[model samples]
Target: MANYVFGVDIGGTTVKIGLFTTQGEMVEKWEITTRTDEGGKYILSDIAASVEDKLAEKRIEKSDVAGVGMGVPGPVKADGTVIKCVNLGWGIFNVEEELSKLLALPVKAGNDANMAALGEMWQGGGKGHKDIVMVTLGTGVGGGIILDGKMLAGTNGAGGEIGHICVNDDETEVCGCGNKGCLEQYTSATGIVRMAKIILNTTDKPSKLRQIQYISAKEIFDAAKEGDELAATLVENHGKVLGKALAQIACVVDPEIFVIGGGVSRAGDILIDTTAKYFAQYAFHACRQTKFALATLGNDAGMYGGACSILNQ
Candidate 1:
């Protein structure tokens, strides 16, 4: 086996890279700005140059490296073909081949969310479990499903696109994905604020939320924890939608546990308890025993997961 591995998580604004031992111990991590100009033609080359520089600075030989693993912010086929990553201005192309040729080493790639799930399963919240679902509740809801320690990439590389699942048919507003009433519409960080605004406008609940010029998910959760009835109710409603959706997902994947991550998940016990309570109510009886935990890897999860991908292969 090779001595070290590199993990790369490609984002719209930056690319996070981590150097790790083959045994999964992260040695160092860093980031570089994402140059998305010219249809992202320079992104991969830039990453390759960065990795090369790191190798030289560390005095690590290319032969001693196992391979590089990458997480891209879009659907990626098992063969490393990125369907499209609009965030990076990338079109359909085989990413692994390009990067591998650039570095003259083996490489692997997967969806960013899926990589996060792998990272959790490897050393974070989903540790010791082979079946797991990771939910990231940020500006948008993102998810990744892993079963028996394998990612379900699906035929179109959209297997774990849980956020796009239609949850409400009556929604009149469109989501970023051009869908209405998606699970993301009610469960993401933005979704929390959006719902709070609706409640404050439609009803005179006299919420602390009304005082903030710019309400955020953090403030809402803080108010709920501090005994604000309106905030608590909003949190309950948000949890209800999220729990119900997770229950439906459980019926399909039957994962061992759900790992919650992202900015909104910082609400901690309030988020987990409320969601778990409703999950038990809606989950299939056999699946009600599934567990929920917060992701421990945080922003570094994608990096760990990217490395884990190559190591696993």
Candidate 2:
């Protein structure tokens, strides 16, 4: 009989779980709606049930599994307690201790973005690299930093918050974290849409984008490809902001490579090209030599990271 490991990534709307062999091959995967509005305690019960169901389906005993790892969206204590989860509307809670007791197995926990970075390092784009930075551009910006081959979580495990880095000192749009002018204000999917709307309101340019009922970053990218000056310029502007932000981060971390992921990254080389141009301009000459690559792990990164959490410590 072969032993396996279980990894779970808990998110706002859903929870993804994966079973993997020691060699890193994912043998099974599944997801369940999080129903977070129902409260945090319900989530714990559901997770326990889900693990039991998976074990039964595979005809495996608890002893057959090596360990279980989890990724949470909020700040986690080094000891595995959740400090707070704004998205889930919960305050401080102990996830690791509770889960381990309920499941009768060792459980490791980490911030979701940090786990994603570990996933990339262990099996995805950063496989060969020891020092890496993983950034996710989505509804909001998310990140995880690895330095000198170690997953870096400062004293409270909130250290990898590259998204919260201030990009505009005087600008006012407040972030969910209550700070103003955060990097997410410019680079997230919502930020891109906000930038597009600003152009739409200020310019009288003839654009196919004006016809859309609702605009998204995808529509903006498509319109830019079709030669809409407003859309193209918006992308360029976003690229510049993203590049500048990255350059600043690179100067401090000096990681070997920076992997870009999340939904917005689907724009591919166009986004990469624009961001790279600005990154080159802002980065120190020596830092400009660092590599920027698209993330290869996709959504599965969370699960892989969970499966490999023991390696993180």
Q: Estimate each model's TM-score.
A: 0.99, 0.92
* Runs off by more than 4 Å, candidate 1: none
Scored by TM-score, the top model is: 1
Residue pairs of candidate 1 with colliding backbone atoms: none
Question: Candidate 1, residues 147-230: lDDT per residue as tens digits?
Answer: 888788888789789999999999999999998999999999999899999999999888788999999999999999999999
**Candidate 2 lDDT, tens digit per residue, 1-313?**
3378888999888999998986789998999888677466677678888998989988988777877889899887778888888777667877888888888878888899988988898899888898899999999999998886667777888967988989889977789789998989888999999887877898797788889989998888877878888889889999999899989988888889888899998888888888888998999888998888888999999889888885455
Candidate 1 lDDT (Cα, 0 to 1): 0.95
CA-lDDT, candidates in order? 0.95, 0.86
Over 4 Å off in model 2, which ranges?
35-38
Residue 89, model 1, lDDT = 95
Clashing pairs in 2: none
